[model samples]
Target: MVVLAGIQEGKDAIVEEGGIVALVEAIEDGSVKGKEFAVLTLLQLCVESVRNQGLLVSEGGIPPLVALSQTGSVRAKHKMITRN
Candidate 1:
């Protein structure tokens, strides 16, 4: 999904289908790897698109992201920081 999100069409389809909300939910409740995947997908989805960025925020994505940044696995933290 992260790889797919890198494509414009893939990202738009995901967003149109409410994937942002789903991904946010995953970030809130998923396992360590799941959270990392969610954040990476969201990063790709939001990368040059303000609409997706706003959608991510509207879905309450920030608090969970902050928590993940602080307490998630070291790999996840590195991924978030590097946006990779």
Candidate 2:
């Protein structure tokens, strides 16, 4: 649950390759924090990470992040939608 712990810790700036991949895996595996608050917290971290680093478009992070952005369980899409 490092990813969940990470999000709760507010360390969104560390969405590096390994971290993002881990989060995505957790999300996909249904092992991460399933609570809406936890998921939304992770989502916010992701969005802010991309916005701060501008890596969403340049580093092929968009596709995966877009997929991550579409968990379909909340209203995060309204704030930052990714449709790749």
Candidate 3:
């Protein structure tokens, strides 16, 4: 709920947008399992954020995201890998 609210408020910004950070934090904190459906959704958003920010592949974020691509149902991996 709070994460959604943050996203709504910063609808323009990409990375600094509170919603993206909130969702990432939620996933890292392991609180989003009930919202497991959000994993793919958040990945899509993060890809967009990385693209818009022009983040390098060597950056810290790419590793975990790539690792994430190895798990989950095929559809989830599909979404994450397609962006790479």
Query: Among these predicted structures, which one has the highest TM-score?
Result: 1
For candidate 3, the per-residue lDDT at 11 reads 32
- Candidate order by lDDT, decreasing, is 1, 3, 2
Candidate 3 or 1, higher TM-score: 1
* lDDT of residue 17 for candidate 1: 93
Q: For residues 1-84, what per-residue lDDT tens digits would candidate 2 score against the true structure? A: 335434535454445434444444444455323433334434555543645345334445456446646753445354344311
Reference-based TM-score, model 2:
0.35
Candidate 1 pairs with clashing backbones: none
Q: Residue 29 in model 2: shift from native, Å?
A: 0.7
Residue 69, candidate 1: Cα error in Å is 0.5
Compared with the true structure, all predictions reach lDDT values of 0.91, 0.44, 0.45
How much RMSD separates candidate 2 from the native structure? Answer: 6.4
Q: 33, model 2: CA deviation in Å?
A: 4.3
Better of 2 and 3 by TM-score: 3
**Highest lDDT model number:** 1
Q: Each model's TM-score?
A: 0.96, 0.35, 0.41
Locate the minimum summed-lDDT window of 10 residues in model 2: 31-40
Candidate 1 RMSD to the correct structure: 0.7
